[model samples]
Target chain A: MSDAEIAVRDLTIRYGQHVALKGASFEVRPHEIFGIIGPANSGKTSFLKVLNRMDTFTAGMHFEGQVEVGGRDVRAWRNLYALRRQIGVVFPLPVGLPLSVYDNVAFAPRLAGVRAKADLNVIVEGCLRRAALWDEVKDRLNALGSLLSGGQQQRLTIARALSQKPRILLLDEFSIAVDPVTTMRIEAVLSELKAEMTIVLVTNLVQQARRLADRTAFFLMGECVTVAPTEQFFLRDADLDPRARDYVEGRFG
Target chain B: MSAPPPHPDTAALDRRDLAWYVDKLVAVLVFVGGVSAVVFIVGIFAFVTHEGWGFVSEHFSLRGFFGSIRWAPTSTSNPTYGALALIAGTASVTGLAMLVAVPFSLGAAIYIAEFATGRTREVLKVLVEMLAAIPSVVWGFIGLSVMNPLIIDVFNVPIGLCVLNSGLILGLMAAPIMTTIAEDALKAVPDTYREAAEALGATRWQVTRRVVLPAARQGLLAAVLLGVGRGFGETMAVLMASGHAINLPTSPFDSVRALTATIAAELGETAVGSTHYQALFALGIFLFVVTFVINLSADLIVRGIRKT
Candidate 1:
């Protein structure tokens, strides 16, 4: 559809001779939280990497088929950096980037040529606030980002991901290293973020998808088994794929 | 029916076997091998100090030895042991060599660590190691035969062997080890740092300069310091390239004699227990101390990186 922010067609990814994901097709709509749930080795992370062209540096990683974002083929972009700047990604574990907490949030903005200190301070404060980390680290913004606690580092990473004002945000298991309280806090932040940018959330928690995602996709053994609205997806219905139902019901993954 | 469990006393889990004896023996042997390095270093230091102690107490004057430039150890009339000219010669030549080597070695290291990949990186690394393994005498030969006439023709100086020649030779001699250490430093930086920076839309150069370089700065400093230490201790190449005239050089074209070169050139001619011989031993002590301090500080700086 014209409104779709990301459109994938027959996307297959491989590492050397082994296929990581095969024959997948989907579309992510604008201003919506799209959740992808799968067990380990189901290619959720690989799919996220392809969105920002991280595959370029990953040796032996190959992908076939078209992935279009903003009505253009991702592979057709001559300047991959520009393409990546439009998309933000957060990894499973926190990456605090051997820099100060303030610098971590300001990194992307500085790369985009924001030079004035006052402007940087404003952007950093705003992103940190949005990530719900400002109150905790406001006084110690100059401290090393890596020195922060695990939960704080994850939030700092989220703040950094937000600094670019990206059109799409790809998060891979943002709650893995976060405490339950911090996870709930971040989940609230994501709900607010969906009003501004599209989010592709890959999570192991099925109920988390229920709590946040507007629509959800089920990936099983490297295949896209089904995609449905969050409400109907969890319902035990004849139309629902039995494999997805079994996975969501915790029978087997 | 299930088999009967083995009795605890009969099992004898703690009993020593042939492998245990071999392990203990190997451990003792390796411990001695490791301790021998420290032992040898201490022994050498003790010997140098013992030889130089007589000169220090009986004939040594701190001012004449350090301040005066005239190094007339053989003159029966005065026999002054001034080493200022030699010290300045060593300092100046090493300074110039660092000027020549730092940029070259760092550039090569960055290229190998960040840009080159696969077969190219492997081949370049092997070649650098091979260069490091080249004997100092061979490098001395290159300086004597190739660089001598070339420097004379290019600079229009009367003497081909001068600070310029020796510094250039020394620079080339030190570059291989410096490059190797610097590459190791860069390699020590985690790939995650590079990937994170790259994912944030930073260019490759930006990633290297902003992320990787800052992360590896301590190790890089250690690499440069180790190169300086190597320059201070090198003998054959500097002796061959330097003109061996003791002088306070005002320019790179002026001929000079290094401290290491002086010990190497005249150590054979002096009689036993002679003041001139003892003075040379004093110089040896000085060189040993300077090199030791440099290497120790470099090691400490590298350890600082690990602590962080």
Candidate 2:
């Protein structure tokens, strides 16, 4: 079989009177850095939420398609916690828990039923180092999470998500609120993470997708216009849709 | 530039400086008023201590207090001024009240804030506020006339008013305040926190417990403390349903006396300078101190939450 880890087929989601995903379809390959490029208000976040059944439009609304992850219907799964353990999410802004930095990273694993102190310490340390936050927060892991600076806190959030050893990392504009230098560092970290986990980044930044993503999908007005190799989608004339070109070229109505 | 050569317009500068001086004076006056407002709370403690000082220290005979079944203040006999029985009665009633109040209050708060639809939430919110506004006396009368007789008959108890009577009355009264404050606290939690947890595939119950409740822990604590304070200090409801007995209550069906009830019932008949009168004053002092500690603890928790 092919190595695609997740596939969405003709997924249409609506909330009462509003449609969030209109016949959207895509596939994410294993260990790939795939970017979902969209302008603001394009319903990209909603589509991502639908992957984990976190969409608010679940009741009184219908989905007209199937989302299969690892050859299983995403909806039919009983071990949702285990499934979620293999898939983590980082929100746009840093969500600082009212807990200490150590507890923040240790949260998911503990929830995943990792109770032993030695095991938790190992997982926390490994994830923090992987997220490149250990050096900065190594000594003050006992400090409250809100005490960290913005970029550092965002990195801490990623470490917290990664502590569960997820197979796919869903990042919704993880570095959008950070400085340019910090954003570049996060971009580098994403490239490193791409070697082990599938990284699906939902970003409004067209240039960052151009710079890093191997395959990019362009979302416009709640529809995926094109999904192609990043270089061809950006450089080749025929591979680009008019809307995609407009967005990539910085022209929006 | 030497401050731009004094701005070249000394008279204009002087006018601006005078206005600034007047503003500073007003600001200082306001600051002083703020400080004195804090000092005003300190003064309440002083006033209570000044009048009720020795009465608090004057020891009552525990033998006379517990042995004598009669607590009446006759014209000739020495008054058997005992609050031990009254204190025991108060603890039992309030404890039962808390048992009924806490869970229902928290459940109502969770529903109103997290689960209820928008219109339903609004209606429930208004109803809770209206319940909070209902006079304690009105609630007392309702309990005495409507609820007391029903409970006595349902349980087939001898006392028409019992510990359960006071508990049910105060529990109903305290529910609204707990629900309102707890809802506000739960609502204060940012939406993004819930979204993040849900995205992690946590069930709704898990999200509520692990994320929402922990996030609102301080607020929930404050709500419980506030409820305890209210149940402890409530006079009218307790007076009406507590049966006004100055003896140890043996069961939930037994009549009881609380601190507020003892003071209220006995303060009028005792002579002005008698030990009996001062002991009632001492009970008032005791109630005040208990409520003060409760409120102070709530304040400390709230401040700690704010700092975090």
Best candidate, DockQ: 1
How well does candidate 1 score on lDDT at residue B69? 97
lDDT of 1 by residue, B18-58 (tens): 99999999999999999999999999999999988888888
The 10-residue segment with the lowest total lDDT in model 1 chain B: B6-15
Off by over 4 Å in 2: A1-4, A13-16, A57-66, A78-83, B1-75, B115-120, B141-157, B268-279
Calculate DockQ per candidate and list them: 0.68, 0.37
* Deviation (Å) of A4 in candidate 1: 1.9
TM-score of chain B of 2: 0.87
Name the lDDT of candidate 2.
Answer: 0.81
- Candidate 1: interface RMSD in Å? 0.9
**Which candidate achieves the best lDDT against the true structure?**
1
Candidate 1, A1-253: lDDT as tens digits: 4768999999999999989889999999999999999888898998998999999878889999989999898999999999988998888999999999998888889999999999999999999999999999999999999999999999999999999999999999999999999999999999999999999999999999999999999988889888899877766654888888888889987
Clashes of each: 0, 0
TM-score of chain A of each: 0.98, 0.94
